[model samples]
Structures are given as C-alpha cells and as structure tokens.
Target: MSLIPKSHPRAKSLLIREKLVLGFEQGLVAREGLLAHGRGEAFDYLLGEKTNKAAKQAIKAAAAQILLAKLPIISINGNIAALCPKEIINLAKISGAKVEVNLFYANEKRKKNIIKILKKNGANEILGINPNFSTTLSGLDSARRIVDKNGIFAADVVIVPLEDGDRTMALRKAGKIVITFDLNPLSRTSQTANITIIDNVIRAVELLSITCKKLSKNNKNTLEKIVKNFNNKKNLSDNIIEIRNNLTRRSRFA
Candidate 1:
C-alpha cells in the first residue's frame, strides 16, 4: 500500500518526500514544509542516506536527555506530522514524552487537521489547540512562538525535528534542553541544540526510539554521562569536515 516501490534504491527517502507532497495536498503540510523537505533531501544525499557514527552518538545523547528530563515534549510540525506520525507517536511512548503539535504557519483549520492525523496515528492526548493554555516564547517573533503552556513551555527537555533557528534559540533561552534533527550540520537549529542529530528525521527518530528503550534500563549515572559528554558544536564541526572531505575527494577523482 506504499506510494513508492520498496525495492527502489532511494525508496525510503522518496517515500518521505512523497508523503510531504501528499500532506500539502491534504492540507496537513505547508508550502514551506515542502521546500524545507527538498532542502533536507539534498543534505541526506550527501549523508549517503545513512546514519553516521557521530549521528548515532548524538541520537543516544538525545535519548538520554529525554529519559533524564522530568518533562520531555516532542514538538511536531506539519511536515513531521505528515511524514512521521507513527514514528513520533512511538518515540513519545518509548521516551515517556508528551506529543505536541507546534507549527510555524499557525491556523485553526490546519491545527485541527494535524491533530486529527496524530490521533489517527495513535496519539491520545494531543496538545497545542487551546489558545487559553498558551505562553509566548520571548526570543522568537514567528508563528512558532506560541506554545502550549503545559507542553513546550513547561518541558525540561524538548525534541524539535525540522526546527527553525529562531525557535531553537528561543527554547534554549527559555532554559529547556533542546534536541534537534537537522540535516545541515551548520544550521542554527543544529548548532543551538544541546544534542543535534545530523541525520534524516525518519532514521534519527527510529534509532532514538531504540536507544531510549535500551537506555531506559541503564543507571542514572550512565545516562547522565551520555548527556554530559555530548558537545553540539564539536559534532557539527566534525560533520562539516566530513562533508568537505567527501566533496574534496570527489573533485580530485573527477
């Protein structure tokens, strides 16, 4: 029942792109989300569509942060809802984090549609609809600023996939432990996050879920070490070096 062939070389990634397109037509994704997905796709191609070692370490660190947080919230946008509804739900369940819809192009109609989609995907208590239960994030001036008072606003740790730079900075300013998935290692979102997984959202979330499940059984000290040892700036720099090396080698061969 999948849109693309399972045997296709780029099947998983193509399916992700196709889903975003479908989400746009269904009003679950915005035009900006489509363009953002395309941008991520180009980076994914450079990443070889595989999770690198550093990304895996970052994923483990992210899982540790979530497991250690008193209140962890997974912030989902339209593109995330359209592409990885089930994966988000599963990550939330495994990490004991709450699922909340936080979109940049905020609107009641699209919000409701996204809520319905999340519910259908097994999310029971979706947040982000109650205007009464909202708080303003001071550093951001975009539609992404309004967050549920009990969700992102109150969370000790937050997982923000496909995040914007402003919100990532604002969230950190608000004193929340931020975990982000960004293909571009040099992006502000990636650089600002406490633990930045430089990989595709689909691959990152699944690995994160697995890591969380495994780490859940480990001692608190062990989890704490994982978080303490993660250096977001260094990780980003290393990935950028890898990208440059790849390009350099390709040019020399050509």
Candidate 2:
C-alpha cells in the first residue's frame, strides 16, 4: 500500500501517468513527470491514443496555413524527437517548412548532441545564431540563443511543437506567429500560443499529416480562408469549458 517506493510493481505505470500531466505546466519533461504518466495510462485505457474531431479541425487549419507559407519552419525539441520524429520530418517535407532544433539545455555539448540526432534523421539547414548573441540563452539548447530581427525573427510563421515557455513567450513578444501543441488546455504554453492543439503530440502530428495531404491542392485563398476562420482563443476556451463541464458532470453522477 506504500506509494512512496518505486519498487512497487505498479510504480513505473503510475510514474509515467503523472509526468505526462506535469509536462504541460513545468515545460521540463522527464520520464517520471506527470504528463508522461497520464498519457501512458490514457493509452492503456483508451486503447492507445486518438485525436478528437475538434483537434482534427485545428490541424486542418494549421496545415493550410503552413502550406500557404513561403518559408515555414518547425522548431523541434527533445520531447518531439522522442515521440514523433518521423512524422515531423514528413510534415516538414509536405509543408516545405525547414526544421530547427530548439531545447532548454543551455550547454554547448548538449546542443551538438541534439543537432547530431536531428541531422541523422535527415534534417538540413540548421540556424544557430540570431545576430543578437547574448550569454543568457547559451545553455538553453546550445548553438547560441540569439534573437535578432532575423533568424527565427525573420520567419513569417513558426510551428513549435512540444516547446518551452520562456522562448515561446519571448517569440510572441517579438511579433512572430507561433503554433504549438500542449495537451493540457489550461497550460501557459497553450494559452500563450497563437494556435494551440489540446491533444497528445503523436495524435496531433498524425492528424496534421492527413490535413496536409488534403490541403495539397488548395489555393492561397482557400488556405487563407482556413486561417481566417480558426479562432485560437475561441478554440482553446471551448476546449477548456468542455473538459471542465465533463468533469463536473462526472462528479455529480458519482
């Protein structure tokens, strides 16, 4: 009955569930975090991962906006690589968006390792400097964290999946369009984002691919139409209300 010990047979299962939930708030993901644990248990019980209808709609809008972009880029972090590397690469190829490796580790060696993993998986054209170099974000994913008026700043739109908070907030302040994935509807990363998908990373990525394929023949006006209709704040607020109402109803029933 002791919950404090990892030696318990169910400890690993419980730990994974907890981490998956925690990953949303902390922006630091570890195997033992709550988000990891929750996702594992969700899959175990929900028959292994799925995306809902609302999420698919969001993905369609995302795909259209991305396809219409002249130069779209995806910011890849360690968590994304671990969960959905292949899907990320496929999406990049389809959307014609470049991939950039970004992480929270502010160390040079860590940067090299992360880039190596990305390159081996077929990513080309890495940008390490933003022309406004500072010692602040140096260890925050290696290769120098510089935010100039160029680099990431030059991008019209950026898709940053499984991202960190500080950089995301900073990016928005600098006037960049940011789209991100955060499962928890209440998390800052989700709320702060221009477009947020409240679904598991794997499910979101796969659905994103499907939407991209559908939008392949779409013209600019059509793509813009999709973008014009997707209300990021509205979707997020709706999702939060739905989740909360369901929880309240379940409590009453119990």
Candidate 3:
C-alpha cells in the first residue's frame, strides 16, 4: 500500500485505489475489478464521498433483515476480499451470516487467494468452493450463478457487496432477500436488491456490522418492523435527490 498522509484531501480514496492496485498485482483483484472500482468511485464523487442519510436508513434496514433471516450469507469476491476481509468476517460474526466466496471472474486460483485472506482475517468456514456442492442459479448466465447448495442457494438473505445486476435479480427471483453496497443508486444492482446501501463498501460493511450488533438485542417483532417499514424504491429516490442537492451545492462554489 502507498504511504499517503492523512492530511491529504483524497487520502482515503487514494489508499483505496492503492489497495486495489496491490490486490491486482497480488492476483486478488482482476483488472476488470479495478475498472468497476473506478466506476463506483465516480459515483462516490457525486455522493460527496460520504455516507448519507438514505444510506444509513438502508444500512439499518439491511441489518434488521439480516438478523431476521434464518439463514443469511455474505458473498465475497476478489475485490471485497482484498479491500475489507476483516470487515466481512466481523459482519458475518455479528450477523451469524455464513461467509462465501462467489466471484464474477470466477477461477480456482482467485478463489483460493480470497479464501486464504478471509481465513487469515479470522474466517472459520467459507462456502462456494467445492464443485460437488455447486448448483446453478436460474436466470443468469454469468459465472456468478454457480453457488454452493448450502450457501447462497439455500440462504434466506444474501449480502452481496460490489455485486452484478444479473446476479442480484437472479437472487431476488430465487426468493432470497438481497442486500448490496453500491455507490450508484441508479445501478440495476441497487434497484434490484431488497436493501441497497449506497455507500462505499469499506465503510458500509463496518457500519452494517455495527448496526447488526446494535439491533441484535431487539426482539424479532421489532426487527421485522424495521424490515417491513423500509421501502427500497423510496430510499433510492432519496439518494438520487441527495446527489442532486450535492451537485447544486457544489455548483455554487464553482
């Protein structure tokens, strides 16, 4: 990682870029993943590079959904493995969600690298590796359709950060509650997910973990109320409005 000073205005963003770059070099992130991160970064700029109120609402709802789920699974890809492996593990631990490596650019070596990192970061059991347990999810042609029978296939809720659109739709079609962290509120992944946190994955994961811990003490009825009260469409619309407000505010300075 690069030694970026905290005083730098773009330090955090620069550090994230460095992590992805290093991940690409270390075979933990694909070149395509770098491109995806760049795209998300552009939206982050529109979002003022910070978590907004809409995102916080989504996070709270997502935590409630995860807690209410009988079987929750957190899906991991190479970019996620490289960027926030410890956060992933912590979220899984707090939410009692199973950790699984499910990548769009699926490959054995990359899977091994991701699993190794997760294990190194205190992950005990990760699913979505063995071919014997692999099952194809209906309605998707991407490599992401292949999921472990015990993992995503059977999960009641799935937390898929940095996810693809088709898989998000497919997971929804499969009757699983899907949560995602996407910088772009307008993306299909954001629209398709049951709860979309329009915040950077690194920050969103930690927030979700913390929210899960805080919500864990609540009764099932309370948790269900939180989930039921949330409306994804309304939240996404609010995020769009927020972006417009941000742009308008910045235009004054310009």
Specify the highest-lDDT model's number: 3
For model 1 the local lDDT of residue 172 reads: 95
Better of 1 and 2 by TM-score: 1
Predicted structure 3: lDDT: 0.93
Q: Lowest lDDT 10-mer window, candidate 3?
A: 106-115
Ten-residue region with minimum lDDT total, candidate 2: 130-139
Error of 3 at 31 (Å): 0.4
Candidate 1: stretches off by over 4 Å: 1-3
Per-residue alpha-carbon lDDT of candidate 3 for residues 64-136, written as tens digits (9 for 90 to 100) = 9999999999999999988999989999999999988998887889888888889999999989988899999
Query: Model 3: clashing residue pairs?
Result: none
Clashing residue pairs, candidate 1? none
RMSD to the true structure for each prediction, in A, is 1.5, 6.9, 0.8
Model 2 scores a TM of: 0.73
Per-residue alpha-carbon lDDT of model 2 for 123-233, expressed as tens digits?
Answer: 766655322432333223433255323346567778888665666776677566788877666667778888887677776887887788889887889889999999988
Clashes of 2: 23
Whole-model lDDT per candidate: 0.89, 0.65, 0.93
Error of 2 at 63 (Å): 0.9
